[model samples]
Target: MHRITGSHQVQFLDALHRDHVEVEDRVRTNKAMGLARLPSKSWRVNKGWVLTCNLAADLDAWLRLLTLHDDQELARAEPETMRLRIYHLPARLACHARRRLVRIERTWPWAQAFTTSWARLTALPALT
Candidate 1:
């Protein structure tokens, strides 16, 4: 687990952990309710990377870092841009998945897809 500091960060981390459980439960429930097909075992691997710490701080920092990196890369716009874009992809995907899930209907199929995508995205390796 990541070291959490500050009460707000701790609270956010706790909520994140709880949200992971809730998502897993909802996925199981959807399967039981015959709402959506469960993803394969391979897909489940993504759950391992689900948020264990408060990302609100890290995400804010990442965005700022990305902006700075992007500015520097834009001047070169070749290998640098490609590298920077690849580095930023995971964060972009996570943000997109979060937004998608927020608007997704509570139906079983949509829930399953949302959960699967969310899990897979979070599990993606960070840039070296």
Candidate 2:
């Protein structure tokens, strides 16, 4: 429970509490994404590591927002889950005619989600 001074309406306090919770959630996620450990003794090296972690977190957020929005499991997946199921999958790119194709085992559990994400990403307009 939090104690607040002054007269505040219930709705306003609840909204403020929710916003704080959301920020705390993000901080927890960031810690899980590598902010929990500072592996280097040097300040510069630690700064670089933090930057790398931030980049990875941004990429993860984008992946969920852009490609995995329709996939509930993947949209809420943790970093390690995404890595094991999607990023580190055994797949091969094959050139057939004028198009490239991704070939993966049909029996793979998350194969459909992976292929759907790939197709969605490939269908995006290229930047000029």
Candidate 3:
């Protein structure tokens, strides 16, 4: 790395450090979503694993942006918290009027956030 010089060096260094921290945060979150270790020795398998991790990260970001806008706690939640509270909730599937429905216990602590996110997602127009 080239050494930055001149009177602006401190400002440049601060900006660079900020960017570095952001990158590290992304990697930490990715690890939290199962990217901490590769599960296979094969190159192709590792590649697919990495892609899956990336997709999970993207979906988390979009979920926060599109559905969790009003909830500050959930909007800023880490990957593991989201996995536990939203994705891994106890639920049952049922069908009614030709529509499949997931039924979660009303008393679950995160139930409201989960249902709100579900409603927001369903209300969006489907991609053709």
**Arranged by TM-score, best first:** 3, 2, 1
Give every collision pair in model 3: none
Candidate maximizing TM-score: 3
Model 3 segments more than 4 A misplaced: 1-14
Model 1, residue 20: distance off in Å is 1.4
Clashes of 3: 0
Summed over model 2, clashes come to: 0
Q: Residue by residue across 75-94, what tens digits does model 3's lDDT show?
A: 88988889889999889999
TM-score of each: 0.22, 0.79, 0.84
Q: Which residue segments of model 2 deviate by more than 4 Å? A: 1-7, 93-101
The per-prediction tally of clashing pairs is: 0, 0, 0
- What tens-digit string does per-residue lDDT give for candidate 1 at 1-95? 45546545767878889999977754453333332333335645434323312243244334434433434533223333333443333222224
Q: For model 3, state the Cα shift of residue 91 in Å.
A: 1.0
